[model samples]
Target: MWFVKVHQNVKFHARETTALRTWVPGLGGAGPRLVAADPALLAVVVTAVEGRPLHGAVLTGAEEEAVFRSLGVLAGRIHAGPPSPSPTAVAPVTRADRYAKVDRHLEAARPHLAPGDEEHVRAVVEQAVVLEPLPLVVTHGDFQIRNILLAAGGSLRVVDFERSAPQPVVRDLVRLPDHFDGREDLRRAFFDGYGRLFTALEQAHLATEAVLDAVSGIGYGTAHGDPELVERGRRILARSRAGTLCPAPTPPAGGNPS
Candidate 1:
């Protein structure tokens, strides 16, 4: 069975897919085997992944934990791999790049928000913009549950690498929200699977990044009349401000953060 992904008139998407055909194999089966890319038709053919999306299951407690761990391990491996060429190949997402994204989207999101939400978003962006650059990796760019597919026996593969890039792995890690009811286990399991202890401040910076994504979603939802998406984005921003998912455990002075 073959999976055919057609980009139609989306030149950018076509090119990104073409590039991903070359990149994913280096990850050792983390992604589908790219069969062929038809640039003229703006399409790609790949071996079909015969599995259900991880999101489509009512997983047991242990199964859920295993999935989260798999996510972390997958993330760790992707971070170790090289970047994909989207518009163009770049080093990594710099703080300036992230700040610019905030500047562009925060205004678009302001009209959809409650009082001071815009300022709150900006403050979060500011905090992240001032921190030292984290280590760079080939981030999956969008590591959401929907992007992951789990085959029988818990084997998994991630799809949609068009947005992958060289950026802070936290950019992907922040995909796991801590505020969802009964999601603490998922969060810890992800980190444990990642096998790298992150500093509290780093996690906080990622929280800030997540808010920026929410702000962008809010703007889209408002323009598209999707109240559910708007509400979801609003909830994420609100929880972030309330410190629901933004952890900043203070480290001792002059001591290395784990």
Candidate 2:
């Protein structure tokens, strides 16, 4: 079976193609096999795999935990190998460069936020920008449940590569905190499956990444008429405001937070 994906944006097409060609090799057949690509037309044909996306599925507690754990393992596999080179550069893999992304999305999202929430978002971004650097990995970019597919035998296949890129490892974790919705058991199961704990730096970096994820979601959702995405973005911001996602910045050493 085969599927053809036609992209509207040239960059998305480049990203999807470069990521599929370079990084998919190490994914061990868990990702679509790129069959053909047409750069001029901004389309690619990939072999289709069978399964429904994991989102919106109703499952028992045990089933949910098992699914999340399996997702964690799959994510680990995507991040396991050495970084691969891209023919077309995505964003530069640096903290400063990533902050620019916040600026871009925040500009679009500001109007949609509740009056004072913008201030809180900015404050969180400022603190996050200064944290020690995190290790980089080839991340799945949009690592949410909607992109995960579950087969009949319970095998999972991760799809969608248009957003894939090398970024701070925590970049991939941006959505899971909200997805877990304060459920420590599911979170624990996921990390256990992933086989490692978050570093101090990655832990600290997540809130800022969450900021980026939220703003982009709100902005894109609003423009595209996706109320669901807008609501999810608001939910993430709410968690940040409540100090669960983004908390007050600790004073730096003996210096103030500037």
Output the number of the TM-score-best candidate: 2
Clashes of each: 0, 0
Residue pairs in steric clash, candidate 1? none
Superposed by TM-score, candidate 1 places the C-alpha of residue 26 at a distance from the truth, in angstroms, of 3.7
The most accurate candidate by lDDT is: 2
Query: In candidate 1, which residue ranges exceed 4 Å CA deviation?
Result: 8-11, 83-91, 178-182, 225-228, 248-257
lDDT of 2: 0.79
Model 2, position 132, has a per-residue lDDT of: 75
Cα distance off (Å), candidate 2, residue 200? 2.0
- What is the number of residue pairs that collide in model 1? 0
Worst 10 residues of 1 by lDDT: 248-257
> Each model's TM-score?
0.83, 0.89
Error of 2 at 168 (Å): 1.3
Overall lDDT per candidate, in order of appearance: 0.71, 0.79
lDDT of 1: 0.71
